[model samples]
Target: MNKVIRIFIKDSTLIPVISIVLGLLIGALIMLLGAYNPIRAYASLIEKAFGDLYSIGETIRQITPLIFTGLSVAFAFRIGLFNIGAEGQFIIGSVTAAFVGIQFDLPWYIHVPFAVVAGGIAGGLWGSLAGLLKVYRGVHEVIATIMLNWIALYLSNYIVKFFLIEPGQQRSRILSDSSWLSSSWLSQLFDGARIHYGILLGLICTFLFYVILWKTRQGYELRAVGYNPDASEYAGIHVKKNIVRSMMVSGVFAGLGGASEVLGVFHYQTIHSVFPGHGFEGIAVALLGGNTAVGTILGAVLFGVLTFGATGMKFGAGVPIEIINIVIALVIFFVAASGLVKAIIDKVKKKIISGGSSLPTSQDWKKGV
Candidate 1:
């Protein structure tokens, strides 16, 4: 089993190609249900997601937040912490970003990072609250984060209504012109859609996450603690401190997720409704992405395509948005039980092993190569 697992990780490319193929194959099976034409529904899905520049822009816009939240959730999972409060963190982050932008008048270069940091700090504090309770009071994070989400939601709504509300409307006041990320420059390729350069920022963050998670000693400790906290303690690691730090880092990612939306996409805080269920969907993105940062990015992009594609599934195939959900559910089912896929791979492995093959050993991973 260890040999097989090592091979799978080492061959990294196999997982992605397999995951996509399986998702589509299952989606095709659903189309055969007769209520909808499989070919047209899927064709419409493709056309809408990438058939035009406008839809591509929309896909990127929608995907931006998922990247941050997905990484946030995936990162926490690495440390054996299930960060269910990314939703709350996202809201809190967005509100703080709004507060900073509205309260200050700094230039773009300074203001943008400042706003993003404010959002991240707000989110980190919330995540820390849950971690603190778990570490000090024996509270389950699942309950604490859920409760915090409500608190954040209500508080954010109140802020939006009273403090951030636009002078004449219920929305937030328009951010300073310096804070706006969109410009006529982006119009060169994305039409009027606001797919700004922030996508690059998201990519940079994801890359950093990948590096930190796989290449750092602290990362190994977190993963070890996640798999078995007692074992990590035996190894002399401060388990509680690591837990708190893990949660804080998780919140930072969630906060970045919120900042990406407010800064990169919307340019203002929105009603909680606009961010409805994003943090939740991010869990699915994390899982489908294999709980790795790079995997999460691909999963998020795949999710974005499905979201943007499903509109055509609604219009051209007369299918409802619910079916898009059904499709996603089916894909998730297959990926979660990767054992089924592994079982199939066993056959190929045996044939190769018979060909005088010796699987890689742990020494390879320990090489720090």
Candidate 2:
């Protein structure tokens, strides 16, 4: 019992969990302040997220892209690089996938994978541009990536307008059935829900990320460089190459996210005046997940549930949907403050220990304190 308590106190995962719980408590308080019943609001949110087959499918649909973008940000973060242009990569990937989906006529097996590959390649190249700029020009990645996002946005918009746009429409041509990832059998199973195979693909990628990062020599090199580039360089590791590789891989995930959105849900690309917020939301997911594969998956799911259920809260309890956004923002804030929270927790634990507490005398707990 003591050992478990000590582990729980020191475990990194506990911070995020406690942060989420606190976020929910604050959300409930907000509901009360707004003269709304918190219980009904929460119940409604729960119902809409998991109450029925259709709701479950919608939650998964929302989770699909989140999983991809979350992984993209998390992968870059693991390399000690901040990738703020996942939105751009995602946009380019979607356009590329839509281009392939509409321009080609092939069998389903070939067409689907072909579009996916095109999206991934497009995103990878876009991400690599930032890396190249950082490596050769001494430009900061944050500035380079931010600029590239606009470039990609305008470039993709031009491509759509001049080349791929339908003659009578602003958006690209609708994708062919063969290029879609949605499954008829699965739709039927979910009572005509929009869930697709993309969720499974996201799960596969999550596992693959864990395997590649933990089991591959290249991954070790990337992590080592990220941990300390100067040290790695002195140790004869190709730090520059790893930086480029990490950015490319990060873009691949973002691009796949955009492709999944097009192939599984939207089935076409539309003109965008602004970056879709998915990329930015990914930063929150990566941070909350501590940049771990399993943690990212769980974080994405939590966001998915909140997103899918927010409308239900509005309708069922007369609570504003924006309150859910507030809740999410608070959760992110708390996650960002985990170090401070842990310190306070440790201080409180020490106070209890000095006051004749039943705490263990283990080195782990002491170090945590």
Candidate 3:
């Protein structure tokens, strides 16, 4: 039992699970204080997310982009890079996809892939700029990415407004049917939900992420650089090139997310005055997932349920949507503070182990039992 307890406490996966439970409990307490029924609210949230086919489909739709963005962040972390500019990369990809989908007329087999690839290439190039700055000019990735996010926002808007805008609309023109990733059968199965092939693509990317990181020579080099750049350089690895390559690959994941949203869900790109928030949310997903490929998918699912269920909580249980936001924020906080949680778990485990084999007490010594 003591051994089992120690193993459980030492498992890194326990942290996020505990964090999620704590967040939910705190949220329930908050709801009680606000004179709302937490159980009912949660029930409604679940029902809204998975009660029926339509809800399940939409929930999956919500999860798809997060999977890609989470993979993007997780992939970068494996190479010791902070890809804060996933938002910018995603935007570039979306606009580039929209442009390709609109400009070209081709068969469905060719057109869909062409547009997706265009988006990925655009995002990769955009992300590589930060890598270039870091390698050549000695700028920090965080700073470069932060600046690039704003540039991407404005640049994407310009491309939409000037090149692809629908007349009298604030969004780009719709892609041709050939470029649409939607399957009529799938849509009908989900009762007309906007779910598409994006989720499948995200799963494929997750597999690739795992394969490229753990099973390939390039992945070994990237991990080596991440573990110790000086040693890797001493061992004849091209540290600078790896940095650029890491960023490019990370950007491809985010870019694919953007392209998927345009090609599969919305079928058009909107010129936003602000970010769509997927990139930022992805940071949380990556953190909660411990930057692992499978963990990322799980994290995305948790977030997807919480996000899509917020509406149900509001309409079904009369809970304010702000409460859900607070709950999510608390989850992020707990995840960020996982070191403290681990320490607490460690202390408990130590107590349990020590108690099982503790020295005799003074009374026991005197009695000589």
Candidate 4:
């Protein structure tokens, strides 16, 4: 029994599970301080997120982009790069898809794929810029990605406003039916929800990430280069090439995420003053999932639930939506600080088993003299 318990504690999954619980507990404390009932708020959240078919579809719709962006971050992390520019890549992909979606009118099958591929390519090129800067100019990836994010944002705004704008509207022209990924059958099945085929595409991408990384020679080389560029170079691997490739792939995923938004959900592009923030959220998902393919998928689902339910929480339970953010922040905090939390837990367990009377003050102080 003790051995089993020890193994459970040592398991990789245990840390994330504990962190999630701890975050919820802390969030509950915050809710209490705010004079809100945490139990009622959480129950309402669950009800609105999964109670009905429509809600479930909304949850999956929310999960789709998260899966792509999470995989984008996780994929880059595997290759020793910090892709802070998934937002930029995402924006670029969205606009490129929007451009293709509006400019050409092809068959449904061809048009949909053409727009999606355009988004992926645009994102890949955008992501590769950071990689090029890192490998050639010796610029740090973090700094390059951060700058690229802003550049992508402004570039996207310009493309939409100056080039892609409709004659009389503020947003880009609505995509024709052929360009949409929406499934009539699926929407009917879910009682008129906006869930589309993009979720399936996202899942396919996740599977590809797993297979390419763990089963292919290219993936092996990429991982090798990531582990140690000097050693990989000695082993006849082109480290620079792999670095560029990884970033492009990362951007591809993020770009697809953006394309999913346009083709699957919004169906049009709007001018934006700020980044959509999906890239940064991807960082949180990657960290929570320990940067694994399956873990990232599950993490995205968890975040999706919280995000889709936030509205219900605000309206139904009168709880602030910021509570969800607080919980997410705490979960990341506890994951990052797992060792400290574990040490504290171990000390408490030891004290319980040993029946130790250890105290910071003296024995006399405890004796109530």
**Which numbered prediction scores highest in lDDT against the true structure?**
3
Please give, for residues 1-369, the per-residue lDDT of candidate 3 as tens digits: 487775443345767888888889999999999899999999999999999999999999999999988998888888899999888898888889888988889999999999989988888898899999999999999999999999999999998999898999999998998998887888899998889998999999999999999999999999999999999999999999999999999999999999988999988889898999788878888988989998999999999899899899998879897887788788889888766666665666567666555433333323631
- Clash pairs of candidate 4? none
Off by over 4 Å in 2: 1-7, 167-170, 343-369
Q: Distance (Å) between predicted and true CA of 99, model 4?
A: 0.8
Q: In candidate 1, which residue ranges exceed 4 Å CA deviation? A: 1-34, 167-170, 273-275, 338-369
Clashing pairs in 3: none
> Which one wins by lDDT: 1 or 2?
2
Per-residue accuracy of model 2 over 1-369 as CA lDDT, tens digit each: 577776565446777888888889999998999899999999999999999998898888988888888999999888889999898899999999999998999999999999999999999999988888888888888888888889888988898887778788868878998999898888788878899988888898899889878899988988898789999999999988998999999999999989988999889888888877788778878888888898889899999899889999989999989988898898999888776656656666687777655554344544854
Per residue, candidate 1 scores C-alpha lDDT tens digits across 1-369 of 586766555634454456556777767676667567777888898888887777788788778878888888898888888888999998888888888878789989998889888888988888888889899998888898889889988889888888888766657887775765555566458766667665766788798788878899888888889989999999999899888888888888888777667776777676665446678878878887768887889889988888778898888787776667777776666666555655555666676677545664334323632
lDDT of 4 by residue, 126-221 (tens): 999999999999999999999999988888888888877888877898888799988888998898889999999999999999998999999999
Among all windows of 10 consecutive residues in model 3, the one with the lowest summed lDDT is: 360-369
Error of 3 at 294 (Å): 0.5
Flag regions of model 4 displaced more than 4 Å. 1-8, 167-169, 348-369
Could you tell me the lDDT of residue 221 within candidate 4? 93
Q: For every candidate structure, what is the RMSD over all alpha carbons to the true structure, in angstroms?
A: 4.7, 2.6, 5.9, 6.3
My TM-score estimates for the predictions, one after another, are: 0.84, 0.92, 0.92, 0.91
Query: Residue 169, candidate 3: how far off, in angstroms?
Result: 1.9
